[model samples]
Target: MSLLQNVSSPADLKGLSAPQVEALAQEIRDFLVESVSKTGGHLGPNLGVVELTLAMHRVFDSPHDTLVFDTGHQAYVHKLLTGRHDFSALKKQGGLSGYPSRAESEHDVVENSHASTSLSWAEGIAAARRLSGERDRHTVAVIGDGALTGGMAWEALNNIAVDKDLPLTIVVNDNERSYAPTIGGISHHLASLRATRRYEKVLDWGRETLTRTPVVGAAMYETLHGVKKGLKDIVAPQEGMFEDLGIKYLGPINGHDTPALEEALTLARDFGGPVIVHAITEKGRGYAPAASDIDGDQWHGIGKFNPETGLPFEVSGRIWTDEFNEEMVRLGAERPDLVAITAAMLIPVGLDGFAAAYPDRVFDVGIAEQHAVTMASGLAFAGMHPVVAVYATFLNRAFDQLLMDCALHKQGVTFVLDRAGITGSDGPSHNGMWDMTISSIVPGLQLAAPRDGEQVKQQLREAVDVDDAPTVVRFPKGDVGESITAQRQDGSLDVLLDVQGNPEVLIVGVGAMCSLALTAADKLVAQGHSTMVVDPRWVLPISDDLLRLASQAQHVVVIEDNLVTGGIGASLRSALQEDDQWQPVHTFGVPKRFLEHASRGQVLEEVGLTADVVSTTMLDRLGPTASGRSD
Candidate 1:
């Protein structure tokens, strides 16, 4: 049996000899390369952290020693070591999660997949351990250098450093990229440290030489430490950023070297105070294809691919993201006032095409969602029609900015929320179910949900034209369902009125929900029930035409991919009630809770958003008497 096969947990790993452990690291790497090739996960990050994770397991007693992973994509190796090695059904419906799950393992402390914030979690754990009188246990936070660019990481560092006595070890995994190339002050500081070779050499020599001295050795060591600190301040002004905050800064060590990592970790364990270990590892190590790729973001999260060739599995043609990119390019050409913005996700949201086409018009703010939102608002306020293209989940980070800066100020800011639904495989942190519920609370904001590629184009145009208040156009992650030609473009209202007669049931479908609604309508028609499937392009600001249709219909079913509570359904229900019409309304959407990792289709199916489920629900509601009337 292989070394990997023998190991079920860290305890099992601890039983192996040093040479055996070294061999096991290679075995684990091979397993990862093979497993992720089939499963399609954060392969690059996981491949980079094998030795670091092995060293961590060796150094610390986990479940007792709190180990927090920032942006849990890199925790795949940690997960495997903690006995979640069954990668057969990884990220699928009934399989292992993409991120750390507390339910899955005792070792997995935090389930944060977002960049930065692990330091905060580590500090919290350290504080709790102290309170509980478990001082022997260590709190280790493993964060990528890319994640350190985020403001929250610095805030946590500042707080952690305040209490020098706190037992914490922050492992800075410097892979030189987070989705894209890392930006900001922290990246530069790390780069400077990496360039400086004398810092490590001097420290090592000083420590060795000072200890050997017979008398006044301790005093000489203290004096040498002060001199080293003074020199570091000159070489790297920001070198003492963490140390100044009261935390001791360790080496910019080679993270891939098992012995080196183990040694550094041992030192950290021995040190009874806050310390930051800066370890450098190449992202996508061992895999030449991924390592050589200049654009690391593209290879960061991949689909099922051939391990040998690094070729992805075939998927459906052009998605909504592609369509958005095409439209944005066209719009930018037509309107010089139009500007595109994203929070470090230029490639994912299909903005790479737009950025390439009009580099001057596109702005990529690095991992600062709140800043991106407000910056877009500023652009809009300055007469530029700013379109902030962001993932639906990430937009939640800037809710207050969207409300106060854009909505309250009545800035003509257009928000194109991509992946605005149950985005599976990426796990819970990535799902866009909260966009509708959260945006529904933003006053003076107009919200839209497009059915397909054509609707997305039309709605985007309309949103850009609305120069009065903030407007949001949301669409799902995958391909646009059944390409439809543009029919009519009524000013700010893209209507597809295909109602046969005075329909009793009006299926008001939001963005991606239109396809399911149409299928449901077909089933209702077969059951002899007269139904009207209307694509109400705008979800918010309840259009007069939409309200009129809703008032006339006996029952209205509001279909959206977002949460049922506090969604567009609630707005529709309120609009119908205020009209003095007692029309019964049913909301079909995801429940207001964190769902498990699964495919978008599987998640939708589970939540009864599929065509079959919708059809059955409509049939059950509109029984034999209602089924008598033919369209």
Candidate 2:
């Protein structure tokens, strides 16, 4: 009676009748809502793809067929079908991963969460199969319409089009959104395709009418279906984009209809070439709360919430995003020359308020980070200071563009990197740990890591004022917390903690790590060791004050929320070494390794970033009797 529990693998779906499959779909949706509500995972995207993913598994032999999901967040349904049913500890350490993990199952092929990459992965996999002479094996890439806006997707499409013999099937899951509603030309094309419902209706009519008449009538209808392309040209003229590219095109199929999805996918599996099976599905189909969300982002990636009311249990306080959101609105009013840009996330990066107030000034370039960065450079060339807001991890996509277009040409573009540092639950790919390291390599790029809400506002203003080069203001994921005021200003450095005696320990905290640095300094002070803590507002171009302080101290400690290697701490140590000021500098930061999924606090504690740990480590480095005076 329980269709979901009985169905453990794709093999189990083979024996089930059409009615059973339909029941299983509803079961899957109910399971998703209940499980994800408790665990706080990607509920909406998974719900939308239930029927689509079910149809794929039922049609193709996965693990052998090789199905890759673009932006693997939607692979939750895929995970369930492949025997990973426990959703109790999703996105937690020692539990199931939010994205597809190779260690979890053989069914998952690609695990990268970055969007617009499935087409390229499919291309490579399909090409390898061809060279290996594995004709029976097929490759399927389920890419969202939002991902199609990316330049890499187009590049892969161009490559795949030329290879008619490549055994690849591209399913464009046209959900009409990626966080926000998808923008640009690809979305428009998909919208046009969705509008051709008349053509589908006519075919359905012909099939029903012809089958009833007789054998001759069925034959006539089959002939009509074969030449439906010419008929489509007359009826739906906007339908040849994929066909023109030498890839076989099939249906603007209803993605939620399991039977209809099966028919389209089966045809694609047998086609033996690169085919684009366009599926039109809702972002949030079954769940009433997600489906009714007007702005379309609340359920995209949600926190733990009540399934009945669809509200979070705890009300969030003013976060890092809130500060950025308020400041952007104020900045829009003050500076007309300030324009805003986001890859596709207008709402997520705190530009929604700015867009609402000054609609003409903000641009959502879809899921194309490279284009957004270079376009910002062009806007800068035209005398407007463009603010490109994006997640710190995503900034990795446009490194060459930032280095060559913005920095090389001397463009004044402000990059607001939200969710910087250890973003624990989303896993390794989502963490913003590499921005400081990567941005440090770029010449004339001034980077800032804001300590609190007030500093996020202050540093953002300073970032936009630079007209000769690019600037970056990065902050972490959660709450901004209590603001830490400075005891004294030391030439652009904010000294939060200073001891009366001659300081032996000099602690330099970068951005959000300043609070932790001050806490660690207090621990040393309580132990009768004089310690001084300072935050260099602008982390780059290692300040004269920092070098002067480092020279006077017996031990220099630099802590940051970025990669220890090549981060600001490393840069400061290198600067000190270059100046021949060897005060035995110690750098503290995220280790240069892929971290597992956990809470931010849990990850920090594991990495020994706690106040107690840091102070004890510093004390051990200094002898037990060591104090303000070294000897």
Candidate 3:
């Protein structure tokens, strides 16, 4: 039997010898590649943390000590150690989640998938524990070097530094990568300390030589310790950044070495105060394909693939991201003032091509979304039109920045939100359902949801042209299917299906839901209800054209992939009410709740966003009139 098979909980790890633990690490790595290759989850980040996790389990009593993981993508090993070994249906409906789940295990805490939040969580937990007089229970936050790029981690660090009594151990898993290679000043600082051989030897020499001189030896070591920060920098450029903050710093220890990680962790745990244990490790250490992937394309967040060949089972078609990618490069060539910014995801949001084309113009602001948004405002102030590309869910982090800094000042910044709505498998935290609600409240911010690849390109150009207010262009996660042509155009509206006379129902589809709206319109028309379908490409600000069209119909049906409350439909309803035009308005969308992990289609169906569900509900609401009875 394998070592992994024998292990169930963190307690099971304690019984194993050092060599046995090393064998278990290999077993875990092999299991990860095999299982994740079939199931498709985070494979690279988890592979690197096997030994570090094992050491953590051995040193700290979890569920009591309170171990927290930043971003939680790397917590798959932690899950396996804590008794969740089933990987057959990972990220599918009713299956294990991609990140740390509170419902799945007690060992898991701070299940938020966003980067650089673990430190703040650890600080709060540690401070509360100290106030409650629970000194025995330790709090360890395992944060990546990539996550440290976020401003929140440093904000938490600044607070954690002053409080010397908190029993908190911060494990800086300096694997030199997050979504991409760790960027900015903090990353460069960590990179300088990666070469620790000389520093390690110098410490060994000091320990052996200084302590041998009896009473004076101890005093001599103490005398040298006063300027140790400078002395250490002379030897290896360790300027004692953490020590300057008043937190105890330890190790440039090998993260893969089980015994070394255990030793460093034990010291940090028993330190009786906040400590930073900086361990050097590699991402995708055991797997050749993953480790060699410098661009972080296939391995970081993967799809189903062959285990041996490391090739994907299916090559996805040109997606919504590809539309943006080509347009960005073209925009770069046409406009000299055009610049782009991303919050650490240089590649995921399709900015890599733009960044390469206009290297100086593209700014990768790390995982600091708030900083990226405000920084775009700064760029706009300098006469450069900045396009901020980021995942829709992450845009939530910068709402204040987008509102106060950008919109308040009338900065002409364009935010291109990728994976805009109902991103399944990654779970509720990842869904981009709240963008429309939040962006709608921003006074001058114009929001657009593109229906197809052509609209994605066309709308993006239109958004960049607006030089007085913040604009948002959102698109979904998958392939932008065939373009749906309109029968005719009415102002900014694309009338897909215009019934000859005054229609009983006006179906307004927002973004990708336009196709689904057309499907429902067919169903309604088949039942003898006069249905007119239109795509208000830009849904925010409640267009006068849309209000007029809604007034013409007996019932207005608005469909979107965003939350029902305070969405485009809600805004339209309020506008019509203010104009004193009362018509029965029906809205169908994702309900205000945390949707569980499932396929996008499954979630849409469950939430009654599908054509059959929506059409049936609309028919019931309309009742058996002359229009419906004609069928």
| Each prediction's whole-model lDDT (CA) | 0.80, 0.87, 0.88
Per-residue C-alpha lDDT of model 3 across residues 321-428, encoded as one tens digit per residue: 999999999989999999999888988999999998899999988889999999999999999999999999999999999999999999999999999889988998
lDDT over C-alpha atoms for residue 49 of model 3: 96
Candidate 1 lDDT by residue in tens digits, 1-631: 9888777788887667778878887888788878988988898888888889998998788887888999899888898888888999899988998889998999898886887789899999999888889888999999998778766887888788778668888899998887877766777878888876543563465446547765332234334445344223322322556656767776777888776676566556655667777889888888887787677775798888888898887566789898898998999889999998877778888788888988999887777788888998899888899999989998888899998988888999999999998898777889999998988888888888888888789889989999979999999987776864334543444444355557878887888877777788788877777787777778787778788878878889888899999888888898878988778898899987788899988888888888888778877877775436532
Which stretches of candidate 1 lie above 4 Å from their native place? 15-18, 202-240, 485-497, 626-631
Residue range 105-187, candidate 2, lDDT tens digits: 99987778999999999999999988999998999999999889999999999999899778898999998988988878788
Clashing pairs in 2: none
TM match of model 1 to true structure = 0.92
Error of 2 at 475 (Å): 0.4
RMSD of each candidate relative to the true structure: 4.2, 3.6, 4.2
Q: TM-score for model 2? A: 0.94
The TM-scores of all predictions, comma-separated, are 0.92, 0.94, 0.94
